[model samples]
Target: MIQKKAYRFLLFLILQSCTQAQTFNKAKLDSFFVALNKNDQSMGNIAISANGVLVYQNAIGFSQINKGAKTPATIDTKYRVGSITKMFTAVMIFQLIDEGKLSFETPLARYFPQLPNASKINIREMLDHRSGLHNFTSDSLYSTYMGSLSLKLK
Candidate 1:
Protein backbone atom coordinates (compact mmCIF):
# COMPACT_ATOMS: atom_id res chain seq x y z
CA MET A 1 0.00 0.00 0.00
CA ILE A 2 2.85 2.45 0.93
CA GLN A 3 4.73 1.58 -2.31
CA LYS A 4 1.69 2.36 -4.46
CA LYS A 5 1.14 5.69 -2.65
CA ALA A 6 4.81 6.68 -3.15
CA TYR A 7 4.66 5.85 -6.85
CA ARG A 8 1.53 7.99 -7.27
CA PHE A 9 3.20 10.93 -5.49
CA LEU A 10 6.25 10.62 -7.75
CA LEU A 11 4.06 10.60 -10.87
CA PHE A 12 2.19 13.69 -9.62
CA LEU A 13 5.47 15.53 -9.01
CA ILE A 14 6.73 14.68 -12.53
CA LEU A 15 3.47 15.90 -14.09
CA GLN A 16 3.55 19.14 -12.09
CA SER A 17 7.14 19.86 -13.19
CA CYS A 18 6.30 19.22 -16.85
CA THR A 19 3.23 21.46 -16.67
CA GLN A 20 5.13 24.33 -15.06
CA ALA A 21 7.94 24.10 -17.63
CA GLN A 22 5.62 23.92 -20.66
CA THR A 23 3.28 26.73 -19.51
CA PHE A 24 5.90 29.38 -18.92
CA ASN A 25 4.71 32.84 -17.85
CA LYS A 26 5.10 34.61 -21.17
CA ALA A 27 3.32 37.76 -19.89
CA LYS A 28 5.85 38.07 -17.07
CA LEU A 29 8.70 37.69 -19.53
CA ASP A 30 7.25 40.38 -21.80
CA SER A 31 6.77 42.73 -18.86
CA PHE A 32 10.40 42.26 -17.80
CA PHE A 33 11.65 43.10 -21.29
CA VAL A 34 9.23 46.03 -21.54
CA ALA A 35 10.64 47.44 -18.31
CA LEU A 36 14.16 47.11 -19.71
CA ASN A 37 13.13 48.86 -22.92
CA LYS A 38 11.43 51.72 -21.02
CA ASN A 39 14.53 52.18 -18.86
CA ASP A 40 16.86 52.11 -21.91
CA GLN A 41 18.70 49.16 -20.44
CA SER A 42 18.66 47.00 -23.58
CA MET A 43 18.16 47.48 -27.34
CA GLY A 44 18.17 44.21 -29.21
CA ASN A 45 16.25 41.05 -30.01
CA ILE A 46 16.17 37.91 -27.89
CA ALA A 47 15.00 34.41 -28.77
CA ILE A 48 14.53 31.44 -26.51
CA SER A 49 14.01 27.87 -27.65
CA ALA A 50 13.06 24.56 -26.11
CA ASN A 51 13.64 21.17 -27.76
CA GLY A 52 14.36 22.76 -31.15
CA VAL A 53 11.18 24.87 -30.93
CA LEU A 54 11.22 28.62 -30.35
CA VAL A 55 9.41 29.56 -27.15
CA TYR A 56 9.91 33.33 -26.80
CA GLN A 57 11.05 36.04 -29.11
CA ASN A 58 11.10 39.82 -28.51
CA ALA A 59 12.69 42.97 -29.80
CA ILE A 60 13.15 46.32 -28.06
CA GLY A 61 14.45 49.87 -28.55
CA PHE A 62 15.69 51.69 -31.64
CA SER A 63 17.86 50.20 -34.36
CA GLN A 64 19.11 53.57 -35.48
CA ILE A 65 19.07 57.03 -33.87
CA ASN A 66 20.11 59.77 -36.27
CA LYS A 67 19.59 63.50 -35.57
CA GLY A 68 16.99 62.69 -32.86
CA ALA A 69 15.04 60.49 -35.27
CA LYS A 70 14.74 56.87 -34.20
CA THR A 71 14.11 53.70 -36.17
CA PRO A 72 12.40 51.16 -34.00
CA ALA A 73 14.33 47.93 -33.80
CA THR A 74 12.69 44.70 -34.92
CA ILE A 75 13.59 41.01 -34.90
CA ASP A 76 14.58 41.36 -38.57
CA THR A 77 16.83 44.36 -37.94
CA LYS A 78 20.36 44.07 -39.30
CA TYR A 79 22.91 45.84 -37.12
CA ARG A 80 26.41 46.52 -38.38
CA VAL A 81 28.57 44.17 -36.33
CA GLY A 82 31.78 46.19 -37.04
CA SER A 83 34.94 45.15 -35.17
CA ILE A 84 33.22 42.10 -33.68
CA THR A 85 33.78 40.44 -37.05
CA LYS A 86 37.51 40.68 -36.45
CA MET A 87 37.13 38.66 -33.24
CA PHE A 88 35.09 35.97 -34.96
CA THR A 89 37.51 35.82 -37.88
CA ALA A 90 40.44 35.49 -35.54
CA VAL A 91 38.78 32.67 -33.62
CA MET A 92 37.89 30.74 -36.79
CA ILE A 93 41.36 31.23 -38.26
CA PHE A 94 42.94 30.00 -35.04
CA GLN A 95 40.69 26.94 -35.07
CA LEU A 96 41.70 26.16 -38.64
CA ILE A 97 45.35 26.65 -37.79
CA ASP A 98 45.01 24.35 -34.76
CA GLU A 99 43.39 21.71 -36.97
CA GLY A 100 46.34 21.92 -39.41
CA LYS A 101 44.08 23.16 -42.20
CA LEU A 102 45.78 26.60 -42.19
CA SER A 103 48.82 28.33 -40.80
CA PHE A 104 49.73 31.83 -39.67
CA GLU A 105 52.27 31.90 -42.49
CA THR A 106 49.64 31.24 -45.18
CA PRO A 107 49.74 33.95 -47.84
CA LEU A 108 46.53 35.88 -48.46
CA ALA A 109 47.06 35.38 -52.21
CA ARG A 110 45.92 31.76 -51.86
CA TYR A 111 42.42 33.06 -51.09
CA PHE A 112 42.39 36.60 -52.56
CA PRO A 113 44.83 36.74 -55.42
CA GLN A 114 43.05 39.76 -56.91
CA LEU A 115 43.98 42.06 -54.05
CA PRO A 116 47.13 44.15 -54.41
CA ASN A 117 50.21 42.60 -52.77
CA ALA A 118 48.13 39.63 -51.60
CA SER A 119 51.11 37.33 -52.08
CA LYS A 120 53.07 39.40 -49.56
CA ILE A 121 50.27 39.46 -46.96
CA ASN A 122 50.29 36.60 -44.45
CA ILE A 123 47.61 35.51 -42.03
CA ARG A 124 49.75 36.67 -39.10
CA GLU A 125 50.17 40.13 -40.64
CA MET A 126 46.40 40.46 -41.23
CA LEU A 127 45.51 39.28 -37.70
CA ASP A 128 48.05 41.73 -36.25
CA HIS A 129 46.72 44.65 -38.38
CA ARG A 130 50.10 44.94 -40.10
CA SER A 131 48.97 43.78 -43.55
CA GLY A 132 49.07 47.44 -44.83
CA LEU A 133 45.56 47.10 -46.29
CA HIS A 134 43.76 50.38 -46.88
CA ASN A 135 40.78 51.16 -44.63
CA PHE A 136 38.01 51.45 -47.25
CA THR A 137 35.40 52.53 -44.66
CA SER A 138 37.48 55.62 -43.82
CA ASP A 139 37.42 56.99 -47.38
CA SER A 140 35.31 60.02 -48.36
CA LEU A 141 33.35 58.02 -50.98
CA TYR A 142 32.60 55.19 -48.54
CA SER A 143 29.10 56.50 -47.73
CA THR A 144 28.27 56.83 -51.41
CA TYR A 145 29.58 53.37 -52.07
CA MET A 146 27.49 52.00 -49.23
CA GLY A 147 24.38 53.70 -50.71
CA SER A 148 25.06 52.07 -54.06
CA LEU A 149 23.17 48.92 -54.99
CA SER A 150 26.30 46.92 -55.72
CA LEU A 151 28.70 46.86 -52.73
CA LYS A 152 31.15 44.58 -54.52
CA LEU A 153 34.76 45.67 -54.55
CA LYS A 154 36.24 46.58 -57.92
Candidate 2:
Protein backbone atom coordinates (compact mmCIF):
# COMPACT_ATOMS: atom_id res chain seq x y z
CA MET A 1 0.00 0.00 0.00
CA ILE A 2 2.79 2.40 0.84
CA GLN A 3 4.53 1.73 -2.48
CA LYS A 4 1.32 2.41 -4.45
CA LYS A 5 0.81 5.67 -2.54
CA ALA A 6 4.41 6.70 -3.25
CA TYR A 7 3.97 6.07 -6.93
CA ARG A 8 0.86 8.28 -7.04
CA PHE A 9 2.72 10.98 -5.14
CA LEU A 10 5.55 10.88 -7.63
CA LEU A 11 3.18 11.27 -10.52
CA PHE A 12 1.52 14.22 -8.79
CA LEU A 13 4.88 15.86 -8.26
CA ILE A 14 5.77 15.50 -11.92
CA LEU A 15 2.54 17.13 -12.99
CA GLN A 16 2.99 19.90 -10.47
CA SER A 17 6.52 20.56 -11.73
CA CYS A 18 5.34 20.93 -15.29
CA THR A 19 2.53 23.30 -14.34
CA GLN A 20 4.89 25.43 -12.32
CA ALA A 21 7.35 25.63 -15.20
CA GLN A 22 4.69 26.96 -17.59
CA THR A 23 3.33 29.42 -15.03
CA PHE A 24 6.74 30.79 -14.17
CA ASN A 25 7.72 31.14 -17.81
CA LYS A 26 4.54 33.03 -18.57
CA ALA A 27 5.19 35.43 -15.72
CA LYS A 28 8.72 35.98 -16.98
CA LEU A 29 7.38 36.84 -20.44
CA ASP A 30 4.94 39.32 -18.93
CA SER A 31 7.74 41.05 -17.05
CA PHE A 32 9.76 41.27 -20.24
CA PHE A 33 6.92 43.00 -22.13
CA VAL A 34 6.44 45.34 -19.21
CA ALA A 35 10.09 46.37 -19.39
CA LEU A 36 9.99 46.75 -23.17
CA ASN A 37 6.99 49.01 -22.95
CA LYS A 38 8.44 51.03 -20.07
CA ASN A 39 11.52 51.98 -22.05
CA ASP A 40 11.57 55.25 -24.03
CA GLN A 41 14.07 54.16 -26.63
CA SER A 42 12.95 53.03 -30.06
CA MET A 43 11.19 49.75 -29.61
CA GLY A 44 12.72 46.56 -31.01
CA ASN A 45 11.54 43.07 -31.77
CA ILE A 46 12.42 40.10 -29.61
CA ALA A 47 12.67 36.47 -30.66
CA ILE A 48 12.68 33.86 -27.95
CA SER A 49 12.31 30.12 -27.97
CA ALA A 50 12.46 27.49 -25.27
CA ASN A 51 12.53 23.78 -26.00
CA GLY A 52 12.43 25.00 -29.60
CA VAL A 53 8.95 26.32 -28.90
CA LEU A 54 8.50 29.99 -29.56
CA VAL A 55 5.90 30.96 -26.98
CA TYR A 56 5.50 34.73 -26.90
CA GLN A 57 7.04 37.53 -28.90
CA ASN A 58 6.36 41.19 -29.70
CA ALA A 59 7.67 44.16 -31.61
CA ILE A 60 7.21 47.78 -30.56
CA GLY A 61 8.34 50.85 -32.45
CA PHE A 62 8.00 52.95 -35.57
CA SER A 63 9.28 51.21 -38.67
CA GLN A 64 11.21 54.20 -39.92
CA ILE A 65 12.92 56.29 -37.29
CA ASN A 66 13.06 59.43 -39.38
CA LYS A 67 9.48 59.33 -40.66
CA GLY A 68 7.88 57.96 -37.46
CA ALA A 69 5.70 55.74 -39.60
CA LYS A 70 4.03 53.34 -37.20
CA THR A 71 4.50 50.22 -39.23
CA PRO A 72 3.13 47.23 -37.43
CA ALA A 73 5.94 44.82 -36.70
CA THR A 74 5.52 41.08 -36.55
CA ILE A 75 7.67 37.97 -36.25
CA ASP A 76 7.72 37.76 -40.03
CA THR A 77 9.48 41.07 -40.40
CA LYS A 78 12.68 40.59 -42.40
CA TYR A 79 15.28 43.12 -41.48
CA ARG A 80 18.89 42.66 -42.24
CA VAL A 81 20.08 40.09 -39.70
CA GLY A 82 23.50 41.64 -39.96
CA SER A 83 26.23 39.05 -39.41
CA ILE A 84 24.29 36.65 -37.22
CA THR A 85 22.68 34.74 -40.11
CA LYS A 86 26.08 34.44 -41.74
CA MET A 87 27.36 32.24 -38.94
CA PHE A 88 24.50 29.78 -39.38
CA THR A 89 24.73 29.81 -43.20
CA ALA A 90 28.49 29.46 -43.10
CA VAL A 91 28.26 26.45 -40.79
CA MET A 92 25.93 24.70 -43.23
CA ILE A 93 28.16 25.56 -46.17
CA PHE A 94 31.23 24.26 -44.36
CA GLN A 95 29.41 21.07 -43.39
CA LEU A 96 28.68 20.40 -47.07
CA ILE A 97 32.30 21.16 -47.86
CA ASP A 98 33.47 18.66 -45.23
CA GLU A 99 31.18 16.00 -46.72
CA GLY A 100 33.16 16.25 -49.98
CA LYS A 101 30.01 17.49 -51.69
CA LEU A 102 31.54 20.92 -52.01
CA SER A 103 34.83 22.77 -51.69
CA PHE A 104 35.52 26.21 -50.27
CA GLU A 105 37.91 26.96 -53.09
CA THR A 106 35.53 25.84 -55.84
CA PRO A 107 35.46 28.52 -58.51
CA LEU A 108 32.25 29.86 -60.00
CA ALA A 109 33.60 28.81 -63.40
CA ARG A 110 32.93 25.16 -62.47
CA TYR A 111 29.21 25.83 -62.63
CA PHE A 112 29.01 28.80 -64.98
CA PRO A 113 32.10 29.27 -67.08
CA GLN A 114 30.43 31.75 -69.40
CA LEU A 115 30.88 34.69 -67.03
CA PRO A 116 34.20 36.48 -67.34
CA ASN A 117 36.38 36.25 -64.22
CA ALA A 118 34.15 33.50 -62.78
CA SER A 119 37.28 31.54 -61.97
CA LYS A 120 38.46 34.37 -59.74
CA ILE A 121 35.58 33.82 -57.30
CA ASN A 122 35.54 30.88 -54.87
CA ILE A 123 33.15 29.66 -52.21
CA ARG A 124 35.70 30.50 -49.53
CA GLU A 125 35.97 34.05 -50.81
CA MET A 126 32.19 34.39 -50.80
CA LEU A 127 31.87 33.19 -47.18
CA ASP A 128 34.69 35.45 -46.03
CA HIS A 129 33.20 38.61 -47.65
CA ARG A 130 36.14 38.74 -50.08
CA SER A 131 33.90 38.15 -53.10
CA GLY A 132 33.97 41.92 -53.78
CA LEU A 133 30.42 41.50 -55.05
CA HIS A 134 28.71 44.72 -54.17
CA ASN A 135 25.84 44.41 -51.76
CA PHE A 136 23.07 46.03 -53.79
CA THR A 137 21.32 47.03 -50.59
CA SER A 138 24.37 49.01 -49.55
CA ASP A 139 23.56 51.62 -52.13
CA SER A 140 22.08 54.68 -50.42
CA LEU A 141 19.09 54.50 -52.74
CA TYR A 142 18.07 51.17 -51.24
CA SER A 143 17.37 52.73 -47.86
CA THR A 144 13.79 52.52 -46.54
CA TYR A 145 13.35 49.07 -48.07
CA MET A 146 11.04 47.56 -45.46
CA GLY A 147 9.24 44.72 -47.25
CA SER A 148 10.59 41.21 -46.88
CA LEU A 149 12.46 39.64 -49.77
CA SER A 150 11.44 36.16 -48.60
CA LEU A 151 7.81 36.72 -49.45
CA LYS A 152 8.71 37.84 -52.94
CA LEU A 153 10.78 34.74 -53.49
CA LYS A 154 8.03 32.50 -52.23
Candidate 3:
Protein backbone atom coordinates (compact mmCIF):
# COMPACT_ATOMS: atom_id res chain seq x y z
CA MET A 1 0.00 0.00 0.00
CA ILE A 2 2.75 2.45 0.89
CA GLN A 3 4.66 1.69 -2.28
CA LYS A 4 1.54 2.19 -4.39
CA LYS A 5 0.88 5.54 -2.75
CA ALA A 6 4.46 6.63 -3.28
CA TYR A 7 4.36 5.55 -6.91
CA ARG A 8 1.20 7.56 -7.53
CA PHE A 9 2.72 10.60 -5.84
CA LEU A 10 5.85 10.33 -7.98
CA LEU A 11 3.79 10.00 -11.14
CA PHE A 12 1.76 13.09 -10.22
CA LEU A 13 4.92 15.11 -9.62
CA ILE A 14 6.41 13.97 -12.92
CA LEU A 15 3.28 14.96 -14.82
CA GLN A 16 3.13 18.32 -13.09
CA SER A 17 6.76 19.06 -13.93
CA CYS A 18 6.24 18.04 -17.56
CA THR A 19 3.48 20.60 -18.18
CA GLN A 20 4.41 23.76 -20.12
CA ALA A 21 4.05 27.28 -18.77
CA GLN A 22 0.85 29.08 -19.83
CA THR A 23 0.55 32.62 -21.20
CA PHE A 24 -2.45 34.94 -20.89
CA ASN A 25 -3.59 37.93 -22.99
CA LYS A 26 -3.86 40.75 -20.49
CA ALA A 27 -4.97 43.30 -23.11
CA LYS A 28 -7.95 41.15 -24.12
CA LEU A 29 -8.96 40.66 -20.50
CA ASP A 30 -8.73 44.39 -19.83
CA SER A 31 -10.82 45.18 -22.90
CA PHE A 32 -13.48 42.67 -21.90
CA PHE A 33 -13.74 44.09 -18.40
CA VAL A 34 -13.82 47.62 -19.77
CA ALA A 35 -16.69 46.72 -22.03
CA LEU A 36 -18.59 45.09 -19.21
CA ASN A 37 -18.17 48.14 -17.00
CA LYS A 38 -19.09 50.54 -19.80
CA ASN A 39 -22.27 48.65 -20.70
CA ASP A 40 -23.32 48.06 -17.06
CA GLN A 41 -23.44 44.38 -17.86
CA SER A 42 -21.54 42.88 -14.94
CA MET A 43 -19.82 43.80 -11.72
CA GLY A 44 -17.20 41.79 -9.83
CA ASN A 45 -13.54 40.90 -9.64
CA ILE A 46 -11.64 38.48 -11.83
CA ALA A 47 -8.24 36.92 -11.28
CA ILE A 48 -6.31 34.55 -13.46
CA SER A 49 -3.34 32.50 -12.32
CA ALA A 50 -1.10 30.02 -14.05
CA ASN A 51 1.20 27.53 -12.35
CA GLY A 52 0.66 29.19 -8.97
CA VAL A 53 1.56 32.61 -10.38
CA LEU A 54 -0.93 35.49 -10.48
CA VAL A 55 -1.20 36.61 -14.10
CA TYR A 56 -4.05 39.10 -14.07
CA GLN A 57 -6.59 40.71 -11.77
CA ASN A 58 -9.32 43.24 -12.43
CA ALA A 59 -12.52 44.54 -10.84
CA ILE A 60 -15.60 46.25 -12.29
CA GLY A 61 -18.83 47.88 -11.05
CA PHE A 62 -20.09 49.29 -7.83
CA SER A 63 -19.60 47.64 -4.49
CA GLN A 64 -22.57 49.22 -2.77
CA ILE A 65 -25.38 51.64 -3.63
CA ASN A 66 -27.30 53.50 -0.99
CA LYS A 67 -29.35 56.67 -1.10
CA GLY A 68 -28.34 57.24 -4.72
CA ALA A 69 -24.68 57.06 -3.72
CA LYS A 70 -22.47 54.38 -5.26
CA THR A 71 -19.26 52.85 -3.98
CA PRO A 72 -17.03 51.52 -6.72
CA ALA A 73 -15.70 48.00 -6.39
CA THR A 74 -11.98 47.29 -6.09
CA ILE A 75 -9.95 44.13 -6.33
CA ASP A 76 -10.13 43.82 -2.54
CA THR A 77 -13.83 44.54 -2.21
CA LYS A 78 -15.92 42.22 -0.05
CA TYR A 79 -19.39 40.99 -1.06
CA ARG A 80 -22.12 39.20 0.78
CA VAL A 81 -22.49 35.50 0.06
CA GLY A 82 -25.45 33.59 1.43
CA SER A 83 -26.23 29.90 1.00
CA ILE A 84 -23.65 29.48 -1.76
CA THR A 85 -21.09 28.77 0.98
CA LYS A 86 -22.86 25.49 1.62
CA MET A 87 -21.92 24.28 -1.87
CA PHE A 88 -18.19 24.89 -1.31
CA THR A 89 -18.31 23.38 2.17
CA ALA A 90 -20.05 20.32 0.82
CA VAL A 91 -17.60 19.82 -2.01
CA MET A 92 -14.55 20.13 0.28
CA ILE A 93 -16.04 17.78 2.85
CA PHE A 94 -16.84 15.27 0.12
CA GLN A 95 -13.26 15.43 -1.13
CA LEU A 96 -11.91 14.72 2.34
CA ILE A 97 -14.26 11.78 2.74
CA ASP A 98 -13.31 10.46 -0.69
CA GLU A 99 -9.61 10.61 0.25
CA GLY A 100 -10.21 8.60 3.46
CA LYS A 101 -9.35 11.61 5.61
CA LEU A 102 -12.95 11.83 6.81
CA SER A 103 -15.99 9.60 6.98
CA PHE A 104 -19.70 10.27 6.47
CA GLU A 105 -20.44 8.91 9.93
CA THR A 106 -18.00 11.25 11.67
CA PRO A 107 -19.84 13.28 14.29
CA LEU A 108 -19.71 17.05 14.11
CA ALA A 109 -18.67 16.96 17.75
CA ARG A 110 -15.28 15.72 16.62
CA TYR A 111 -14.50 19.25 15.50
CA PHE A 112 -17.26 21.37 17.02
CA PRO A 113 -18.11 19.94 20.38
CA GLN A 114 -19.56 23.25 21.55
CA LEU A 115 -22.22 23.25 18.90
CA PRO A 116 -25.67 22.24 20.10
CA ASN A 117 -26.21 18.49 19.81
CA ALA A 118 -22.98 18.24 17.85
CA SER A 119 -22.47 14.68 18.96
CA LYS A 120 -25.69 13.68 17.32
CA ILE A 121 -24.87 15.40 14.03
CA ASN A 122 -22.88 13.50 11.46
CA ILE A 123 -21.09 14.63 8.32
CA ARG A 124 -23.74 13.08 6.10
CA GLU A 125 -26.55 14.85 7.94
CA MET A 126 -24.74 18.17 7.85
CA LEU A 127 -24.00 17.84 4.13
CA ASP A 128 -27.64 16.96 3.53
CA HIS A 129 -28.90 19.88 5.66
CA ARG A 130 -30.54 17.43 8.00
CA SER A 131 -28.42 18.21 11.06
CA GLY A 132 -30.96 20.61 12.55
CA LEU A 133 -28.33 23.30 12.74
CA HIS A 134 -29.53 26.82 13.46
CA ASN A 135 -29.44 29.28 10.59
CA PHE A 136 -27.67 32.22 12.20
CA THR A 137 -27.19 33.79 8.79
CA SER A 138 -30.85 34.81 8.83
CA ASP A 139 -30.11 37.26 11.61
CA SER A 140 -30.10 40.91 10.63
CA LEU A 141 -26.55 41.47 11.86
CA TYR A 142 -25.01 38.68 9.82
CA SER A 143 -24.09 41.01 7.00
CA THR A 144 -22.55 43.52 9.37
CA TYR A 145 -20.09 40.98 10.71
CA MET A 146 -18.40 39.81 7.53
CA GLY A 147 -19.13 40.15 3.82
CA SER A 148 -18.71 37.39 1.25
CA LEU A 149 -16.19 37.01 -1.60
CA SER A 150 -16.00 35.08 -4.85
CA LEU A 151 -12.82 33.78 -6.51
CA LYS A 152 -12.06 31.75 -9.59
CA LEU A 153 -8.72 30.55 -10.94
CA LYS A 154 -7.69 28.95 -14.19
lDDT of 1 by residue, 1-154 (tens): 6654564475356445544685766686677667757866667887767778887778988877889999888887766677999999999999999999999999999999999999999999999999999988899998997766233421
Task: Estimate the TM-score for candidate 2.
Answer: 0.55
- Candidates by TM-score, descending order: 1, 3, 2
Question: Considering summed lDDT, which 10 consecutive residues are worst modelled in model 3?
Answer: 145-154
lDDT of 3 at 140: 89
Distance from true location, Cα of 122 in model 2, Å? 1.2
Give the best candidate by lDDT: 1
Predicted structure 1: lDDT? 0.79
**Model 3 Cα shift for residue 10 (angstroms):** 37
Residue 14 CA error for candidate 2 (Å)?
20
Candidate 1 off by > 4 Å: 1-20, 148-154
Higher lDDT: candidate 1 or 2? 1
User: lDDT (CA) for every model shown?
Assistant: 0.79, 0.64, 0.75
lDDT of 1 at 61: 88
